[model samples]
Target: MSLAPRIVLVHRTTEYEELVARHGTHGQAAFFLASRGRDIEEVAERSRRTRRALDEIAAGIPLTWRQARVERADLDRFLFAPEDVVVVVGQDGLVANVAKYLAGQPVVGIDTDPGRNPGVLVRHRAADAGALIASAVSRAGAVDELTMVEAVADDTQRLLALNEIYLGAAGHQTVRYRLGRDDDRGAVEPQASSGVLVGTGTGASGWLRSVWQERGGGLVLPGATEERLVWFVREAWPSPVTGTSLVAGHLSVGARLQLTVESDRLIAFGDGMEGDAVELVWGQTVRVGVAGVRLRLVG
Candidate 1:
């Protein structure tokens, strides 16, 4: 008996039918994926509808579908082998990291959002809505919405954010923060501020920098000698003490002063992540690093 062509499916989506019709598994095609909650039923219904749509495009193409649990070992097998084709049905984050894993293979990304794919490699570009969809399609993968179609390769290969991320002062209290890498030998007092910020190249235009009387900013640009991150903060506040005599127009005897970040916590946060509140001690350190991979999108 001859074996049918096999195509590994990653992240369930509606685009599989066109893939199956064009390249039938001949009964050997199987799907491997992590549990997607209870959406499998919906996918099965969509598959039936997709089969009907494919009939008009290509007649008499037989397709048999089955899904199996995915294990860590199975992940290794799928990534290394050269299958007929591999379809990724994950969110933007999933797609971006997947590319790194299957660096040399042909992995077709499928997502409802278009911005995940880096379309034409425009110089010094930031990911936008239009750029996302076009990126995926331009890469040889196809694009469609709410229906199955041949997957394209126009992966713009950029970051995809499901929820928006922002930086701003909490409450009315102006915060004191700092920006700057560790000095020689990772020592030395870091730069201090009433406000500081570190954001992605894309986040430069956003709220990385809060309101600063001295310098209105919140950014660490490219060509920065060490790491590429922005930071912001407030510096100091001296508390005035008014004695009974002072209230009566007499001189005061004592006063107190407090640092900004000490009184108020400097926090960093955005969508899908819990906020981190940091109180920096003069000699201590707080570090931020870039994630290993950018986000991905498929339309």
Candidate 2:
């Protein structure tokens, strides 16, 4: 007789008792439980239930708890087995860690964002709670050896979205730059003043906010609906005027035209990531593109 296919269920906390209770004996499987050392009590309780269920399902089957050496190798073992299925239960951070460890595998994450993880099935608690959307966007470019997955929202169909990327300064001050083209390629022109901002639909919310805040916190690009655009300014400054006065001054850009920041401590952040120090001068083209990789997910 052929044995049932194996499934590996990974739980982060003790609350996953219900999960083990329901699906523990449904098939031939193993349970891998771990914790980030954040909540010990929860981990203890969950570990007990998970072990009980696993023991009940398959007598004398191996049960492994969180150990130092179980890092990526253990994850690889689960994936290399064609007869095995890995189910991860945790938040986006935990999901990302597992996905990174598994890299290329027919694995799935439960209750987390599926962004940046290709060829993986992601189920979100938002979907289980009847929310209309269940999707995570990764502005942090592509990783090696992965492909995009089909996404499924709560009570919605599966779909895919393009990757979004961005780069910007860190502080509330303005970093000036010029706009033009590079080798016939449309690029920011040669100039200096405050800072520059480049972003996509996914990154607009993050990098865009810094620029917006420096520009007196008004609507960005008043008449432009372009989702992908870069802003190059020669000068920027934080508003010091009180309430309505600042609003009035912000609405009237006469004062902003003369204000400029002069500091070499400017930093670049992409997808909310603070990058290493790299010299950026006039006419230097910082290329941002829709990476040739796609991320996929399943309900």
Best by lDDT: 2
User: Runs in model 2 with CA error above 4 Å?
Assistant: 1-89, 92-109, 112-122, 125-173, 181-197, 200-268, 275-284
Best-fitting candidate, scored by TM-score: 2
lDDT of 1 by residue, 163-238 (tens): 2222224442444332233222422222233333334333333343232223433222322122233333334333
The TM-scores of all predictions, comma-separated, are 0.30, 0.34
TM-score of candidate 2 relative to the true fold: 0.34
Over the full model, what C-alpha lDDT does candidate 1 score relative to the true structure?
0.31
Error of 1 at 261 (Å): 8.3
Candidates in order: C-alpha RMSD to true structure: 17.3, 15.1
- Over 4 Å off, model 1: 1-180, 190-195, 209-227, 234-267, 271-285, 297-299
Give the lowest summed-lDDT range of ten residues in model 1: 243-252
Tens digit of lDDT per residue, candidate 2, span 1-299? 64443444554443344445654731211233323234334544545644543333233222331111122224434343333434454433334334422323333444432343332233433223111111111112222222221222122322222221222245535454333322334422333434444332333344455656776765553221222333434243433421111111111111111111234443443332233223333333343322233222223
Error of 2 at 246 (Å): 24
